[model samples]
Target: MSESDFTVRSVPMLLSRNKSQEWRDIVLLRSGMLMRFLKTHNLLINVEPFDENGNVKDDLVIKKSHLTDDGLELFKKVIPGWSQYLDKGGDVNNINRLIKGLEKIRNQ
Candidate 1:
């Protein structure tokens, strides 16, 4: 998917002033789901871990967009069965696929 297709919008909250913190929390909570979706589409470019304060924690980066053949092979190995559960089509299948994929990933 393109970056534009994945854009997240902000909503005004009457009771919350810490929008940055809220965004970080939301991202942290949904990171796994986002990773799964990216893997399914073979579009995962990089994964950077961060602390609660949004500080980068590690230097390990996987830029699939710039990967060579060997790098792609390694990435595939690292993310085995990445899109194995993504073939189901309709709305029901889509929901089932997501639930099953999340359960499998969480279990692992």
Candidate 2:
């Protein structure tokens, strides 16, 4: 996809009413499909929004990095080609499987 195909919109990441954080939200769409695609191909850290109707929205937050040093080594040992994805980001379902994968890599 061309650069236009990937849109990084800057929005305020609020820490609280008085404090905030800065981050970029990357979104990819072609023919109306939104995948969290990153050049680094790392596992994405995602945030989902639930509507008042109890339906989940497509909104997600994609961090630029995935995998801690130990996790990276573990992943590389177990899953070949894991490093490419670690250095990038892509969409995978947000579920227990993902949670478990991240749990292993998360900082202690």
Winner by lDDT? 1
Off by over 4 Å in 1: 1-23, 45-108
lDDT of each: 0.38, 0.31
| Tens-digit lDDT track of model 1 for 1-108 | 563322221122311435577555443333444344445544444543344555433232334453334334433443233334332222212335444544454455
Q: For residue 105, what is the lDDT in candidate 1?
A: 45
Model 1 root-mean-square deviation? 11.9
Candidate 2 lDDT, tens digit per residue, 1-108? 532322222122211223322211122121012122221234323433234653323343222233334434433443333324432654323223333444565534
Indicate the residue-level lDDT of 55 in model 2: 36
